[model samples]
Target: MSSTRFTDALTRLVDALPEPDDFPSTARNRELTARVGTWLGACFLLAFLTGVWSHLAQLPDPVLPLPTRPVWLYRVTQGVHVAAGTAAVPLLLVKLWSVFPQLFRRPPAVRRAQVLDAAERLSVLVLVSSASFQLVSGLANSAQWYPWSFSFRATHFAIGWVAMGALLVHVAVKLPVIRTAWLEPQGQPAQGTVSRRTVLGVTWAAAAVAVVTTAASGVPGVRRLSVLATRTGTGPGGIPVNKTAAAAGVARAAADPAFALVVAWGDTERRLSRADLEAMPQTTATLPIACVEGWSASGVWGGVRVADLVDLVGAPTGSAVLVESLQRVGASSRSRLPGNVAADREAILALTLAGEPLSLDHGYPCRVIAPNRPGALQTKWVSRLEVRP
Candidate 1:
C-alpha cells in the first residue's frame, strides 16, 4: 500500500480503541502534565549524574581518581541514583497518562507545524523507551536477576547516555510550554469530583514512600525503614557478600592450610602466610563497599596498608597493582588497581573485619578494599598482588 494509505489505516486502528469518558490526557490537564514533566526531568538528571559517578568509580582508569575521604561518598551517590530512579517511575507513568490523548491528536494544518509535531512525538517515544529500560533494568540489577543475555553493566551504561540525550531534547522542545505552566497561578477547583492538585499530591506521596523504602540499601542508619532493601548490609561479619566461597569455587583454595598471599613488584616478590600477613604492621580503617547493586555497609577493616605491601616488594609509591582472586571464573577475578588506590593509606588487604577474621566470602586471608571503589572491584579471596612500576 502507499505510505499515506498505510498511515491512515494505522490511525484508524488507533482511534478505534475505546477511550473512556474520563481518560487521562493533556486535554484533561495540561498544567498537571507540565508539572509532572518537570519533576520527571529532575529525576532523570539526578540519576544520570549519580550513575556516571558510579560508572567512573568502577573503571580501571577513573575519569579522575575518586577521593578516599568522606568515605561514604559512593554509598550516598549510588543510593541517590537508585532512589531517584525509583521515584521517577511514578512521575513517568503519570506524565505519560496525562499526555495519552496526544498520540491520536489530529495533525496540524500547516506543514511546518506538522513536521515539528512529528519530531516531538518521535523524541517522546525515544525518551519513554529509554527511560523505561533504565528504571526496569536497574531494579532488576538490584535484585541480582539476569533475565537477559546482554551484560547489564555495559548495556545499562550505554542506554543511560541515550536516555539523557533524549531527555535534553525533550526538555528543549517543551521549554516554552513548561515555562508558561510554571508561571501561571494554580487553577481554582474545576467544580469536579476531584482536583488536579489532589491527584498530584497523591503521586508525590507515593514517590516519597518509594524513596524511603528503597533508600535503606545505601543509608545504614535508615535500614529499618527500607522494606524493599535487598541487601541487608548485615551478614557473617557485619557485611553481606554477593558470592560465597563455595559459590565462587574458592572454598578449597581459600581454606587451604598453605594459603599465602604472593605480592610482586617488578624484580622482587614476597609470599606471606596468614600469620606472616598478620605479623606485618597492621592498621585499621573504616570503609564501605558501596556496591553497584545499591547496598553498602561500613566495616572496621584491619590489615596491612596496600602501600605497605607495595613498599615491601620494593615498589615505589604510586605503582598500580594487579589483584588476583582465588575464584577461577568471573569478570572481576583479576582486577587492576590504579596507582592512586595502591598508594592510599586507607586502602588495605584486609585480614579482619569488625575485629573478627574475614569470612571466606569476604576474602578470608586477604582482600583488596580500596576507597571510593565499587564492590565488584573489591577483589575477594585475593591470592596474588602483581605490582607494576
Candidate 2:
C-alpha cells in the first residue's frame, strides 16, 4: 500500500481504539512514569556496570588486570548486580503501568512528527522487552533454574548491551518530556481516587522488599531476613555447594585411593597425594566464594600456595595455569588462572576449609581457591594443574 493509504488505515484503527484519556487517573500521568523510570534507569545502569565486571572476570584472558586485593570485591559487585536487577522489576512494572495508555494513543498529525513518534515507540518496545528478559533470566539464574539450552551468561551479557543501547535512545528521545514531568509538581488526584504519591510510595516499598528478600543469598548480614533466598550461604562445611560430587560424576575419582594432583610445567610433572599436598608448607587465607548465581560465602581456606606448587614443577614466575577437575562433564570442569592470579600469595590448592578436610561436595581431595575470583573459576575437585608456557 502507499504511505497515504497506510496512514489513513492507521488513523482509522487508532480512532477505533480506546483513547488514553478514557482510562485517565492522576496516578497514570507523565510525572508518575518519570518518577518510576528514574529509579528503573538507575537500577539498569548499576546492573550494567557490575554485570560487565562479572563478564570480564570470568573471561579466559581478561583484557584488563582484575585486582587481587580487597578479596570481597566480586562478592560485593555480584551481590549488588543481582540486587539492583531485583529492585528494577517492580520499578519497571510501575513505569510501564503508568504509561500503558500511550500504547493506544493517537499518532502525531504532522508527517515528520509521526515518523519520530513511530521510531520512539519502536525503541521503547526494544528497551522494555530486553529489560524484562534480563530481569527474568537473572532471577532464574540466581535460583539455578535454566529452562533453555543456550548459555545464560553469554546470552544475558549480549542482551544487556542491546537493552542499554535502546534505553539510551529512548532517554534521548524523551529528554524534554522527562525533564518537564520530573520538574513539575504532580497533578492532583481525581477526587476519591488514589494519589500519585501513594502509588509511588507503594512502588518504592515493593522494590525495597524485593531486594531485601532475594539478595540475602549473597549478603550474610541479611541472610535470615531473606527467607526467599535461593541459597542461604550454608551447606556442608559452612559453604554452599552448587555442584555436588555425585552430580558432577566425579565421586569415585575424587575418592580414589590412587588420587594424585598432577602439577606440570612443559615436560616436567609432579604427582602429589593428599598427604603430600598437606605435608607441604601450608597457608591460610579467608576468601569468599562468589558465584555468578549471586551467592557468596567466605571460608578460611588452608592449603599449599599455588605458587609453591608451580615452583615444584619448575614453572617460572608470572606463569598462568590451567586447572582441570576430575569431573567428566560441563564447561566448568576446567578453568584457567592467569599469571597474576597464580602469582598471588592468596591463591592456594585448598585441602581444608575451616581447618577441616575439604568435603567431597566442596572438591574433596583438593580445590583451587583464590582471592577476588569468581567461584566458578575456583576449580573444584582438582586433578591437574598444568602451567602454561
lDDT for each residue of candidate 1 in 1-389, tens digit (9 for 90 to 100): 99999999998997886554436432347688888889999999999999998888877767677777677888888878888999998898888877886666777899999999898889989989999999999988988898999989999999999999999998888888888888984574447666777779978998988888875556656788888878666887788888888889989999898998899877687899999999999999989988887788888899999998888888889999999999879877988888877899998999999999998889897898988777889999999999987
Residue-by-residue lDDT tens digits, candidate 2, 1-389: 99999999998886788978887576677888888998899999999999999889989988787989899999999998999999999999999999888897888899999998898888999999999999999999988899999889899999999999998888888899899987775666667368888998999999989989888566656788898989777888799899999999999999998999899998998999999998999999999999988889989999999999889988897799999999867878999889999999999999999999999999989999999998889999999999997
Off by over 4 Å in 1: 1-27
- Name the 10 consecutive residues with the lowest summed lDDT in model 1: 19-28
**Model 2 error, position 148 (Å):** 2.1
Residue 145 Cα positional deviation in candidate 2, in Å, after optimal superposition: 1.1
Q: How good is model 1 by TM-score?
A: 0.93
Q: Would you list the clashing residue pairs of candidate 2?
A: none
